[model samples]
Target chain A: MCKKPLIDLHDDKLFITFEGELTLYTIANIEKALAYVKTYSFNALQLDFQDVTFLDTAGALFIYNLEKYFTKKEIAVTLLLEDTTQKDTLNLIKENMKSSHKSVPRKQKSFLEQTGELFYNYYIGLLSFLHFFGKLFTTNLRYITSLKNIRFKEIAFEINESAIRALGIIALTSFLIGLVVAYQSAYQLKIYGANIFIVDMLGISIFRELAPLITAIVIAGRSGSAYAAQIGAMKITQELDAMKTMGFEPFAFLVLPRIIALVITMPILIFVADMMAMLGGLIVANIDLNITMELFMDRFSEVIAAKHFYVGIVKGPFFAFLIAAIGIYRGLKVKDDTQSIGFNTTKSVVESIFAVIVCDAVFSIAFTNLGI
Target chain B: MEFIKVRDVRTVLGDKIVHDGLNLTINEGEIYGLLGPSGCGKTTLLREMVLLQEFTSGSIELLGKRLETISERDAQSLRHQWGVLFQFGALFSSLTLKENVALPLIEYTELSEKMIDEIVRFKINLVGLKTEDANLYPSEISGGMRKKAGLARALAMDPKLLFLDEPTSGLDPISAREFDSLILKLRDMLGLTIVMVSHDLQSIYDTLDKVAIIDNKKIIYEGTLQEVTNVKNDFIESFFGKMK
Candidate 1:
């Protein structure tokens, strides 16, 4: 099934029907659905798997995590399994939880220690998606409110000084990126006797990957470092503490604004980078493959699907979110002195770039499998 | 009324004991000095008062309420009642002096721009900075000026209690004395209860109504400067001995 039938119940009963291949990709959606279900006022959840056609380790783990979560909430989970494989998977999860629960000595651990361990594990397990979502929403709220209060002139100055200074470098990087993608794709296209198709290849590649990735990297270096150093230095100096002492949440005032500014500006920058890189590819394609601009445009239209645009746009905010988060996180984590300011700034840029790449990879895999 | 009370406060960082069974009280409008040499846990005690540093044991009561028992929001609310001048005047370099001073006022109040600007200018001028200096960034200012600017930012909220750590450490002798005067003036003018950590003997004598001396991980002396000076102990004597 392309979409799972959502179960709505007044009581604690959760009924879910999944159809299609149950891989890690599909399993994540199911897990999200379960989490959404949990947020409702419910005491018991009964999951129905009557329409689910496939089962895998990924799907099993998804169910297991949900089960563990529900067990902690003291909510009973009843698995309605029609298939033997599904039953076996449920049994495996139940047995695993039982064994692990038994392993921890209840008497040896203090209540706080056990609670701390539980919370830490819960946090780590939900970190990738849940944490990002929380950060994104809360950070957006924080930034919006901070932006409203601050002098608009200061924000303009920051944007002009910090973001505008890096615009040229971003353009240069995106231009070179387009040229590289065109140059690389041209060789393979030439071997296939479709040398003119290099335009199509570069257009799609840049729109779908290189432009967004390059722009994100540029931002990671430029804006991310700026954000880190600004806040990191604030933290180093005790301005962050001063803000708190004055009854202002640092995350709301400091991190929130930068995160908001980055998220708002990054996608626009990516769009700009996309257009410029596409032009770069056009120039290279005309010189290397002798394709006219008109022909190149026609070929790009024919070959570049809407899915490419969807994928590119989808990753923009994700990259923006990641860079802003890593920058702010490293900044806030800074302890003592000017040395940590410099160190965390470097770490923010490096980690932001690495996170952008990894996120791009995951999105690629997810989109490719989803046929988006 | 005593604005802040610390009872049997102890702090351990890993295997190291930072503070052991320390107790103190600061009345309203008193400039209480925590005088100690380096590594005597003065800063640690200061951090505990702000709730930035957790204590291993004991209770910190600010405004007659226990700190650890308060909710996070309440703790934050209580913390907001004080302005802190960290050792370095940790002004947000990204913000101009005006903006740095305006931070607390902006965060806690819904005052109009004219109002905020007025308050910012008032605090800046209170610390003896020119209004032209308000447009300059913290880095653009001198070290002593930065410290004054930090104090201005702290005072922007019109705090009831003020915490200052080494407000005079790196300043010239003149600037240090001036800062001490500012502290005395603030305490007098605003009736601010001040908690400060300093090794500067001149500042101690200039501002503090009472002093708490930390030696060997615990408070060895808790009294006025004259009381601490009269103590025949070598460390206390020698600590004040350099003044003459």
Candidate 2:
């Protein structure tokens, strides 16, 4: 609001009236209004607060200072506040004028300084992440060593929610992945009359890489974000605080169950993904490349070894650990705001997906070097 | 001057009609309170007054301008004339109290950094909060302090009119009384025309100059606080408990 308080100079009396609400918000406008006051020199000043609509402590202080300034000049100052409802607040402000804290100005940081601050925040985030993992590992080891506080029911529920409930989407995506790989690879193999080799391609690709990759990606989107949001919501509502006050370890009670569920589910999901993807490839190979199911099975058994399937399922629990860990970690990162829940959920899903891909690439390099 | 004038205002919420032929005028330098049962749309009527929602039919002229026909520029300009304090304070959770109060100043004016800082401090102090609390986030503060911060944010623009929703519902008796007096002081000093929706009997009895009680899809009672409480109604009796 650029509305400066209007000062109307009348015959033998200076009537300074304020228009609109007089509060800290109007302080800038009030300053401009004061400048309007400073320009005039009247021996007798009558400050009429009759026209002011709303007055608070700031408005009171302004009027008080204005009066003080005039009284200092030996000018007659008449404060007519009889018309305003803020007379009491004005009185209170007048009483407290001596004690009002003079606000100190904080220095503004340069762009480079702000950027350095961000790096510090990032460093803190990394250290906290390491601390969280360390706590989780020790708690998990303690639980393993002592079976007394094991929450079997919660782990079962977690498995049901994050794994059993995720079966449909996982099966669908894995099947599609297999279908896509077989169809694309058959196009190249078919041009050279090597359509029979589609079985080897589908079997090895689906079992070794495609199944585990698609399964991990699906879980990352579904269960990973869910864990983050669930834990974040709990954190926001102070349930985590209540648990800590009651001498309950959040890691043992909350985190371990989800971890156990994810670890158990991941290997099983990979196996399911392997079956579905191979099934999808079989369907695609039979339809697109004119290869019989019998011939496909024969080449599959001969060309693809059992160790290929083991290679895929073996990485499942590790990927699951990465997904669940990041999800819960991001969940714990959620602060007091509602928006942070959504933000942490997104971050968890993204980080889990990235971790999965990075782990897959590492496996690729290692497996290639080892000739597996 | 009539700060807000509503005529033939009909607001339909889904299948139910909330305001049927609603006509009211809020004058300048007055404290108007809205009273109703739990689901009687007291807050909704306040929203209607603020143009947070428009009536299904009829006209509302705020600050001598019809809200329905107002342009975007006019609406944004008109926003400076009034400010609303939502029930939950609705302070930006991420911003500290001072930053929240300074938001409107930064957005609406070209006031210098120093002026903005001083103004923010003043506003926070005006709400009876210490200037030191300005640096604390809303979550770090107590509920009373949060409400005060919200009040500071609402007063950031220093509009001619102010709207409040349940200003004292969560406050204890003393805090509520203090808040009521703060309202009185604001109204007296600034001469602000304010409309508030409140369920607190003490707030209703002590603070407001005028009352509008909505029931049966309309404002059944409208008068000075003395006149409305004098009415013989079962709902009013139960809600206010035969106002002392």
Candidate 3:
């Protein structure tokens, strides 16, 4: 049940009696009462809380604010209270309110200022990333000299999690991609009476570009984001700090194992993806272009160069390094919040994929220039 | 008025029995403490009272609503009548302390943003947090400040009942005492029927009006701190023995 405050206006004095529950549920009615009182020009205002059966913090706040509202207009405000607890609440709120001043509003930034801030943040971020990269590089280099400190068990576990677990998805994705590419090219090649050229097209594209790129993107999405979330959660829970206090280098213990595992597994995963893609292409070629599997292998041996396979497989480690490095880097960059874990995980995936593509592009250009 | 009455409450989590025939009564305007050694299911009973966890076979009547047979509508309304402060503050890491304090009012009431802002600031200050800390996120504040901010949010709704899970567990002695006083002050100021799960002996001595000591799947003692020593229980002896 809700009760509206009884308002009495006589001459220059306004008296209001609040009744029943004075809580969030009844605040709207109290606000209406305040609105009614505001219409009158009163030099003196008395708020009677004796009839108020229930008064919570919100209600006390309203009473306090109402007193402040009329007092600011140079009116005398007096609060009449019979209930000791209500009086204590009002007094507590009043005392606390004295210490809490209004926070200064943030100044709006102009367009140029906003742009400068954005650029500055990115610049700082780039510097931090480079620092992390260098630190990790030196740590790995130092560990290479003394291999006893390295946790091979962690590395093995990470390989199992990031690589061995990823095998099924990799196989399915590469197979579908290979099938689609061969099917699309087979339609065109068949029209030109060049059904045999399907092997050359699939071999060049899948081996040199499609397989490596797809495998990298998959790992970046799968393992890169996971690395970021795992490390970020650890950082949030102060496990990284615990590791440091225990005299263990986090990069070596956490990041290095992931990077080493990915580097070891990436080429293996890509090689598997390569075989699966060829298998898919073989089936498509057989069904679509009426080419026999033996004939496809014979043409493939003749047209597909070892150099194409080398180009694809060689990019695997680089791509893996980029994915794992960026993942761990972004993870280390995570601030002390759950939101930052999600934020960094997203950034890790996007940045690693971008880095993989850029590295692939650079490799393609360098190989072209070297006449390889 | 009996604000909470837990009767014949039994909890079976998988194969482990947490609570068996646990019964307790918390009255209005009393600061109640659920005391037990670690893993005695004190928090579980608190959670069960708040409807966060379910007891296997029991009746928990909170604010005149039976928990097991409560309708969805009644459950929603009952939730509004109480506020829970989880362990570790549990402030939404994404929102600042001000936004966190303002959340319940914004969701439950039709108060304008201006009024809500005033209430939020008042609640923030009422819990002894600085005005400047209002803009900072939960992660930005210290442990004591986080607990205070959490108290602000819990009191945001001006609930009649408050459930706090370990309000002073992680604080230093000074801050812990400060928290104890804050709890006492809030209980007096707001007339809140507080049910807190705590193992802090000093906190138990300072703030609790009545306590139910849970040990070995049942309440070993339920009375004031002054009368607690009369109970013959190993947990009560070891737990409150240090105080003596």
Candidate 4:
């Protein structure tokens, strides 16, 4: 069929003369003709069905769709059915509309019914997870392709400000944490005349858990919150939309850079946190036990194996992913309301921290079993 | 000739049908206004036409290609043909007006910095903003100036099709009128096909070649301004009445 033509009505009313059978075969012809006539301004569509030799349910369904389309636009469609074949089709449409109008008032449910409905919805939601998963999988390639344009400078700024900016505070906290762990362990060791092994205790704790967990927590609050707030505010004000409207994918332009930045920088920060905690432990070992800095270092290297270092570093990127995922998810989920930006930012940080803790525990436990 | 054709688009956000089989045909180089009250889904429909929205069912064709079926790379490249000015004058707060206007050229093309700067300056001048105004960020500029800056950015791409959402909103009467004149001048100079979502009747009448009014989740009126002006319906009359 030819592309639809613009139909202009010259008067308040016009005649639509249909000169063919209203059968299944002729439905396509009728629709083609109607498409051309529907493009322009019109008041009413007059259907001339006198020449129609036959009409079936398919033809009836086509007309029903047309009537619904026109009616919603406030344009009336009048059926001029003169043939017996057309009469049955028109009658069927009228009856369908009447029955739909009478369908039990779309009954409001009782509490029990509502509960049942909620359960049913939840079941359907479980089934619909595949749909969500499929969309994400299909869109993953596009997301990856956007990585090409991510300026390294943009990523560096995001990472440096987000993860590195909190370094001083993290170091301070790690120092206190190290001192406390060392002192507590020394007290317990003193009870058994094994106070000298405090070096092993502080070193193991810092490398294995304290440093990684503390650094992850710091990032979840600082970098993750910033990412969410920035993106969320951009979304609320339509800067993200502006990018899309200008032919730049918002995911590529705004999101990918931050993801790259966090991924690159998180491990580096964890390394810093580990060093600070070790230094704090060294201080405790020297002052409390009268051990030299050199001696403490020698024992720390001996007790904390390469596995601990690898484990901590591995968790950094995973934690980064958790932060980026939560941050971007919360940002993308923000509503148009300006207040939601701050709210979502807070939500992202909390969710990131929670997710990090859970994932870290799972990873540590699984690795402990594997003895990695 | 119809440059953009929407064929029976039916869109729903979950349960609510925002566009119930909405259809529109916009011709080239004409200013078409999608006029409606808030919540009538004019923006949703425009977004659908531009392929920014996914419809539950129906088809959209722009410049002879089926919108839904087009390759994303093609979509991105073809999108250069249209420029959208979002409702809030969505400028990057981090960037100055010149940088904002130059963004598209920088993103879409391999233009050198100097050439991009000259184009950005030309666009800023076209929107009636001074050269000095180009250095100011969106937060530093007046709301009216921001809107003009948005228009300048939209024009920077030199798009054949331009989409605008509430261009006259939040502007003083003079600024609104000035915007209307600038739109007319742009259309005259570039022969741009403009589609805008607006509730402002005065702006609609001043710049539109045709106005499509959305009501009850459908297009209630589509015609010349004079035809809409002559409409006697209470809502239609009151809309024009307020402008008068």
Predicted model with the maximum TM-score: 4
> Model 3 over residues A172-223: C-alpha lDDT tens digits?
9999999999989998998899999999999999998999999999999999
Docking class of 4: medium
Lowest-lDDT window of 10 residues in candidate 3 chain A?
A239-248
Positional deviation of residue A333's Cα in model 1 after best superposition, in angstroms: 3.3
Q: Which residues of candidate 1, in runs, are more than 4 Å off?
A: A1-165, B229-234, B241-244
DockQ of 3: 0.02
Give the alpha carbon lDDT tens digit for every residue of B1-244 in model 1.
Answer: 9888889988899799988999888998888999777887999889888877789999889997788788776887776688888888888877899988887677668899999999888999999899999999988989899989989988887889999988899999988888888888888899899999988877888888988888887788898776677766667978888776
Candidate 2's TM-score reads 0.51
Interface RMSD of 1: 1.8
Clashes of 2: 11
Q: What C-alpha lDDT does candidate 2 achieve relative to the native structure?
A: 0.83
Q: Which ten residues in a row have the lowest lDDT in candidate 4 chain B?
A: B226-235
Output the better candidate (2/3) by TM-score.
3
Residues A1-372, candidate 1, lDDT per residue (tens digit)?
Answer: 445546768555656656665666676666665566666777887766676787777777776776678889998888766889877876786677677755544568889999998999868745754665576576465455654655355456556655667688888888888887787777778788898778667767887888889889888888888788877777767777766666666655665556656666777777788888888888878888888999998888888887786678778888987998888777776777778888889988998899999999999899889878
Q: lDDT of candidate 4?
A: 0.80
How far in Å is the alpha carbon of A328 misplaced in model 2?
Answer: 2.9
Q: Please, what are the lDDT tens digits per residue for candidate 2 over residues A1-372?
A: 336666777765687766667788887667865775666767788877766778878878888888889899888888777654689888887788778787888989999999998999999999999999999987888778877678887799999999999999999988888889888998999899988988878888888888899999999999999999988987775455423322245787689999999999999999999999899899988999888889888888899999899899989999999999999999999988999999999999999999999999999889879998
Rank candidates by DockQ, best first.
4, 1, 3, 2
Q: What DockQ does each prediction reach against the true complex?
A: 0.42, 0.01, 0.02, 0.50
